[model samples]
Structures are given as structure tokens and as C-alpha cells.
Target: MSSPFSNTVYVWQALFLREALDRFFGSRAAWAWLLVEPAMHIGFIGGVWGMMRRNSMGGINIQLWIIVGMLAFFLFRRTAVQTLHALDCNKAFFAFRQVRPFDVALVRASVEAFSMFFISLFILGAAAMMGLDVLPDDSLKVLLALSGLWLFGLGYGLVTSVCMRMVPDSGHIFQILMMPLYLISGTIMPLRYIPLPYRDWLLWNPLAHGLELVRLGFFSNYHTLTVSFSYLYYWALGSIALGLALYRGLETRLVTQ
Candidate 1:
């Protein structure tokens, strides 16, 4: 027989998983919308860039390159967005003693991660259908890079969600700040194309490092010498530590509010 604590944990996990699945697939349109949004964005961006540059950018196919970068970046962005609002969205659930705010955030992150994975596979399939090369040079490296990005996003979301709870207005500001990061993080362009000083500055963004590592895996000829997994790992670890500290210290206040 399971102990009370173990049973409670199991119940909470089941509840969280059910809630996440419902939110993601609650309606027929929900899943479609999730897939369509990324597809449309990738399409527009890839189309314009493809028209502008008939040749490969940095010897990487523009369409495939942009799609991979966008998908990888979206994994982080979507996870963060979902997680930041998880607490407020699931506030009522806190009435159940076993359902903590952290559980809600974890569920949201898991759902986003699950959604992003399929979305990426779909995008790669579509790209292949369009005559774009979709295979990775190093599949293991690609998986590792994506896993790192997901961890980073989850950590970032945990911190930002707590901040949003403390200061509601900060959510809008955070979204605005993320807008510039998309451009600078090499989602639309390769890091190699950027000149020295600017590239050095851009590398400071851990997401940029994640993106470049992902590109390195995708393009056989692409050489990414500057990206350091250690850099991304540290950012993820630090953010998660800080977020957990804040959450643990303020649990009662956060839940009550």
C-alpha cells in the first residue's frame, strides 16, 4: 500500500496532467490553432527571406534554417508564456491542499513542451515536402540543444510567473522585452552572419547560444564554435534556483492572493 504522502503526490500529478490535456485539447479547434499559429508565422518569415535570398544563407538552406530556429525559439517562448500565466489561471485549484502553484506551472510547461515537439516534427515534415532538407547532421546534439532550451524556458517561466504574481503589470513588460530578443537571438539569421562586436554581445543571450547549437546540429556544413552549453546550463540552473527560492518563501502569500 502507498503511504499517504505518496498517494497525494500521485493524485496531484494525475490532476495536473488531466488539466493540461484538457486545456490543450479541450476543443477541436484548440489543437488546430496551436499548430496553425506557428505554421503561419514560419511560413511568412521563411517566404519573405527565401524570396530575398535565392542562395543559402551561410550555406544553410534559408527555409529549413529559419523553420528550425523559429521552432526552437518558440519552444522556449511558448513554454514561458504558458507558465507565466499558469498560477493565475489555475488559482481556484489551489483550494485543493495538494494542488500547489508550482504543480500548475509544471503542468503548463509539460503541455507546451509536448505541443512544441509535435509542432516541430510537423514543420520538418512540411519543409521536406517543400524540397527543403530537414535531416539533422547530429540528431543527438539537436535533442540535447532542444532539451537545454526547454529547461531554460521552464526556469525562466518559473521566475517570471512569480514576478507576474507579485506585480501583474510586469507581464506586459516582459512580453515587450521578449520581442527584441527574437531578432537578436538568431531566430531569423545565423550567428555567423553577424560581425564580431555585435555577435559577441548577442552571444550573451543564452537563447542565442541555444539557437546556434540547434543550428549546428541541423546544418552539416554549419560550424558553431562560440556556443557553450555550459553557459546555457548555468543560466537555467540559476534561474530555477532563484525561482524556487522565491516560490518557497512566498508560497502562502502567493496562494492566498
Candidate 2:
């Protein structure tokens, strides 16, 4: 019934981010590691694919295409990954009299989201300096799309954070399955090039649609693929509902564990 950004939520979010930022800044190495890890992932995985396609690939340079794709996907992945253990990660905060379980999860998710959002800009800037074209063809649309993806991350984070409490192995299962998504979702390769069978199957992943929409801004000539925003919205909505319900239902049990 109340707005999400009402005074209570706003104040809580502000406090959570402030504390988490202090925690994050205290370890400069971890902050730096975010940039380093993404570069390594892009360099090794994206770079090898670029080399293989250099001779025959058509349209945009694969490296540039992938840099942006990785930028978007990495943000999503980092938020989702950290969200899995959101409660456990902030158990110390939970012990505080003022901190509720949802507060702990919200704070952790918001901090990770804020960190990754900046990292994307840093990555884009670094890409530009290194001779890659990271500028969007249409900045406004790209901004809107980025906003959508960011919201999706927040919702997914909330959902995953709660779900992991009920099912401890969800995080490990997600890690194992996430790699194949990169390959099949057209992060490293263009969808047109993927065979019909695989491409059809990938249609089921709403995140794939979001990624492709983001990709369309990078490659102007490619007609954007149709995506189900409603499908993504369903996950976003479902995640929030399920997460809040489970948390409210089982906070005592999880915190005790």
C-alpha cells in the first residue's frame, strides 16, 4: 500500500548504502578487483571468440560488441551472484536492533547494484580510451534500457536473496547454469549466426531479450529482436512477491539458522 521510496524505505536504503560503501571503500583492492575481473572475463572469453571470427565475421567488430554486452551482463551477474547470499553476507548487520532481514538484503543488493553501475561507466570509458567505440548510437534509448536492466537486477536480487535462504544450493546451481546462458543467449555471438534450434530455445530466457535490446543500441543496423517486456516484468514481479512473502514468513527461521 505504501510507496517503495517512502521515508522509511528511503532512509533505510540510504543508511544501508552508506554503511556498505564504507565497507566497500575500506577494501580498495576489492573495488579494483571488480574492474580487473571483468577485463579478464572479457579478455579471455570475448577475445578468443573475436579472434576466431576475425576472418569471416560481418558487421560490427566482435570485440566492441562484446565489451558492451559484457558490461550489461556483468552488472546483472554480479548483483544476482551476491544477492544469493544476501542474508548470510550481512548477518552481522542483522544482529543490530534496527536491521530487519529484508533491510539486510535490500542494503546488500543496493550496494552491489550501485557499485556495478559505476563499473559499467568505468568500463565504457576504459574501452573508449583503448580504441573501442562504447558510445551509444542513441543515448536516451540506451539510458532507458539500462534503467530497465537495473530494475530487473534489483528485483532479481531481492528474489534470489530470499530464495537462497530456503534452498541453500540455489547459488551453486545458478553458477553452474549461468555459463551456458552466455553462450546460448548471444552475448558472445550474434543471434542470427546461432543455429535455428538453439536460437529458438533461447527465446525462453527473458534476460536474453533484455541483453539483445541493449545490444541493438550498439549495433545500429541490426533490427532489434522482439522481446517480451511483460515476460521480464513477470519475473521481476514474481521475484518481488515471492521474496517478500518468504522473507516475512520465515525471517525468524533464517536468521536463527
Candidate 3:
């Protein structure tokens, strides 16, 4: 007889492999597309910056800064977005009694994280080879900050998934909401460009904190707003807790709807 804990572990392993196969190998050159997408984004931005004749931003190598911050944002965005549609993505899996909606959500988030890890490594490796200073001054802090962003993304996905399940129209709104985050989260723009007093307000977006912390970790000389991991994690944990509550309360509806 398998204990529930072991059974859950087995389920996760099965789900992970299934998700991995589909994500990394489901389509022709699927893995290649994954690697190419981000590299292309980075290349385009690097080209733009090169044309502008700018060499640095926020006191760090512009190339490294963009590469690190963009990768971090992608990590969080992928995790959250994938998790948001997890239930629908794995609608077929719900046929099994053991496969709860939240179970699929968790598994989907894990899948994004696993894939992004390699994508980051590959991008950073290529950047370093190209003479970009991609080495982190504080690797541990970089890891922690990036982890926070991912956790928050998972939490965001959970809460939003339930919301979308309850009111399908809101899913469209959530999709739209992600667009502004690219700007406000400081992925491509320097918050310093926003002007002093007004710029501070953007920090209200928890992702801003996570992004700054990542840049700070990567370059000791990197100058940016002071950010707290606590702010980001608070949202992460709180959203996850609330999302779980919603799922527990609406388990029947989630599976049905």
C-alpha cells in the first residue's frame, strides 16, 4: 500500500515527465524555439543599444544587465503564465481521481522553471563567450532573488487560474495585464529614467523589487532602488495561500468548469 506522500511524489514525477516531453519535444524543434526566442529578444535589444551607442545602464555592463534582468522576467512570466492555464492545459489529466487542479498547476509551474533554468544557462554562457561580463558578483543573492520571482509567478498563476475559472472573461484581462508588467517591472527600461519621486512608485509592483535585487546581485556596483525580498515573498506566500483556499473551496467547480 502506498502512503499518500509517496503517491503524491509518484504523481509529480509522472506529471513532470509528461509535461517535459510535451514542452521540450511536443513540436518540431520545440527545444530549439525555446532557446531561440530569448536569444532573439536579447540580440534585438543588444542591437538597439549598440545603435544608440550606449555602453552601460544603472552602472553595470548594459549587455549583462539586460541579459540577467530579461531572463529573470522570463523565468517569472513563464512560470506564472503556464501555471495560469495549467488546469485547461491538462484538462485530460483531471480524468484521474488523483490529479487535482492544483496538482496540475504546481506541476506546470515546475516544468517552466526546469526549462528556464537551462535557457538561462545557455544564454548567459553565450553572452560570456561574446565578451559580455555575465558573471555575478553575488551568485547566491542572484539565485535567491530569482527564486522569489518564480515563487511569486507560481502564486500569481494559482490565484489567477481560479479567478479565470470562476469568471472566464477575466482571463482576457489577465492576459492584457501582463503587457504593462514588461514596462513597469523594469525589464527593458531603467526605472531611473522615470524621474526621482515618481519613479519610487513603480516599486509598488513587487516584480520591480525582484528585478532590482537580481541586478544588484549580479553586479555589486549596480545602482538601483533598494528592494526587499520580503516584499516579493509576502505576495508569493499570500497569493499561494489564498489560491489554495479558493481551490479547496471550489474544487468541484474547478474540475467541472
lDDT of 1 by residue, 1-257 (tens): 88978966786678667866786779978878888988888889878886886557667777777788889999989888888888888888899887777787778888888888888888789788978779898999899899889888888989998999999999998788778988999987777678988888888899998988888888868756478888988998888888888889999988998
The true-versus-predicted C-alpha distance at residue 53 of model 3, in Å, is 1.2
How much is the lDDT of residue 42 in candidate 3? 83
Off by over 4 Å in 1: none
Q: Which residue pairs of candidate 3 clash?
A: none
Q: What lDDT score is found at residue 174 in candidate 2? A: 68
lDDT of candidate 3 over 19-98, digit per residue (tens): 99999999999999988988888888888998998889988888888898899999988898898888778878888988
Q: Which ten residues in a row have the lowest lDDT in candidate 1?
A: 53-62
User: What's each prediction's clash count?
Assistant: 0, 0, 0
TM-score (C-alpha) between model 1 and the true structure: 0.93
Best by lDDT: 3
Q: What is the TM-score of each candidate against the true structure?
A: 0.93, 0.83, 0.97
Give me the runs in candidate 2 sitting further than 4 Å from their true place: 1-19, 26-28, 53-58
Q: Which 10 consecutive positions of candidate 2 have the poorest summed lDDT?
A: 50-59
Give the per-residue lDDT digits (tens) of candidate 2, residues 1-257: 76745756765876676656764676858678877888888788666886676622336666777777777777667666666667777676666555677776666667766787787888778878988777778776566555566666666767666667778888677677668866776677666666778777777876677677676766676544566556666766677678788788988877877
TM-score between candidate 3 and the true structure: 0.97
